[model samples]
Target: MVEAARILFGEHGFHGTGMAQIADASGIRVGQIYRDFESKEDIIAAMVAADLSDFLDEAVLAQAIAMGDRQRVRRWVLDLMIRKQQPNDSTLLPEILAEASRNPRVAAIMREGDQRIRRHVAAALAMLAPHAESACARCVEELMMTLMMGGCSRRMALVEGDWQFLEGCMARFLDQQIAWLADHDDGAAAADHADA
Candidate 1:
């Protein structure tokens, strides 16, 4: 049902798609669909949860951190910032955002998903810079999220020109931020040792 909704939502905006359409696409009865999901918002929540699950495989980051692989951790953060979006995502995300502006339920769902992603980002930042202030991590997190979302908008807008150059610039920016975090944290650690 969620898959069907995703396709329909991508083709048509959130308000454009209907439960009957989802049921028809999924080959499920409308009653059965209702049994699983109360409304389109419910389906949206499930879709977001599934996407988050696929993206936030914590074990990968945990393993990298456990091995003290700073490079891997940095790569992980960089990948999150510049990950490729699925074709459907490019179509569907904007639709959802538009609907979210009018629907309180959808807005709440988006907020919760955003918070989950933010927490995951914060954890990755902390692993990269254990001594860095939370405020610093948060600033990095906000910037990364903005760039990520902006990339999605850029693709959706069908901007002309070479994307690789833009991607390279983004990667360099993130690399510098990560390096600053590492260097700043090291300095803070040394200061603590001196105080001790």
Candidate 2:
């Protein structure tokens, strides 16, 4: 039922999908579904939890970042994202995001996921830049998450052979960015610039 809900919600926006549609697709009775989940929101919540359990391994990500092999680690992460988007993730995510803007339940879920990633990124930054202030580390974490998330929607869609070009770019950019962060005391300059 959850899988059906994911597909239906992706195909038809959250508002467009009906509980009957999910029941029909999953071949589950509406009564049974209702017994399991109180509402459509609950089903979607379960779907998100299932996705997170299978999709992200924060420990592996942290280890990869700690190793400082930007090329390899970034590619590893990219490969995972691309693989996750295999059939229809790219489309599904955008649909959810659009719906989340209007739905408080969805919004809360998305925010929680975002904060989880932010915490992961902050941990990675702390591994790299030991001298970093918590505030500065947080700022870099947010920036990395923003840029990465913005690029992900399309990058996953184009999983061309080997992704060699993309790999090099990701490595070079990450290397430079990490070095810049290392040199800065607390991202104070970047923060200052953003204020203007």
Candidate 3:
């Protein structure tokens, strides 16, 4: 049902899609669909949760951290920042965002997902810069999030080649920031040791 809704929502805006359309696409009965999902907002929430699970994959980050592999963690962070959007996602996300603006429940769901993302980004940043101020890490987190969302929006608006060029530029920018954070943290540690 969720997959069906994702397709429908991508083709048509959130308001344009109906339960019957989802049921038809999924080959499920409308009654069963309603029984499973309280409302369209619930379905959207589920979609957001699923995407978050796939995107964050916290186990990967946790394992890297546990292994004390700074380079591995750095690579994971860069991968997260520059993930490519699926063709479906390119359209579906904008529809979700448009609905979120009008529906408080949808907006709340999006907010919760955003918070989860922020926490994950913060953890990655901490690995890069253990001594960095929380405020500084947060600034970087916001910048990364903005770049990600802007990339999605650009994909939705532009042709493939146009966005790919901008994407490469953003990826390079994120790579540089990650490298600087790691270097800065190493420098700070050296200074502290020298003082000791």
Any idea how many clashes model 1 has? 0
Write the residue-wise lDDT of candidate 2 on 77-183 in tens digits.
Answer: 44443333436576678877886889999899888877766666666566566566666666766667766675666654664455566556656765665676677
Once fitted onto the true fold, the runs of candidate 1 whose alpha carbons sit more than 4 angstroms away are 186-196
Question: For candidate 1, which ten residues in a row score worst on lDDT?
Answer: 178-187
Which portions of model 2 miss their true places by more than 4 Å?
A: 62-86, 155-163, 185-196
How far is each candidate from the true structure, as Cα RMSD in Å? 2.6, 5.4, 3.4
TM-score, one value per model: 0.88, 0.76, 0.85
Expressed as tens digits, the lDDT of each residue in 1-196 for candidate 3 is 9999999999988989999999999999999999999999999999999999898878999998889888788767766766767769878988899889999999999999999988888888787777664555677889988877776676677555654566577668867776666655645766988999
Q: What would the per-residue lDDT of candidate 1 be over residues 1-196, giving only the tens digit for each residue? A: 7998999999988889989999999999999999989899999999989887777666778898889897887777776766767679878888889889999999999999899888878878888778776667778889988987787687788777477787788779987887777766756877888999
Q: After superposition, how far is residue 119 of candidate 2 from its true place, in Å?
A: 1.0
Query: lDDT (0-100) at residue 21 of candidate 2?
Result: 90
Which prediction has the highest lDDT against the true structure? 1
The lDDT values for all models are: 0.83, 0.69, 0.82
For candidate 2, the 10 contiguous residues with the lowest summed lDDT are: 77-86
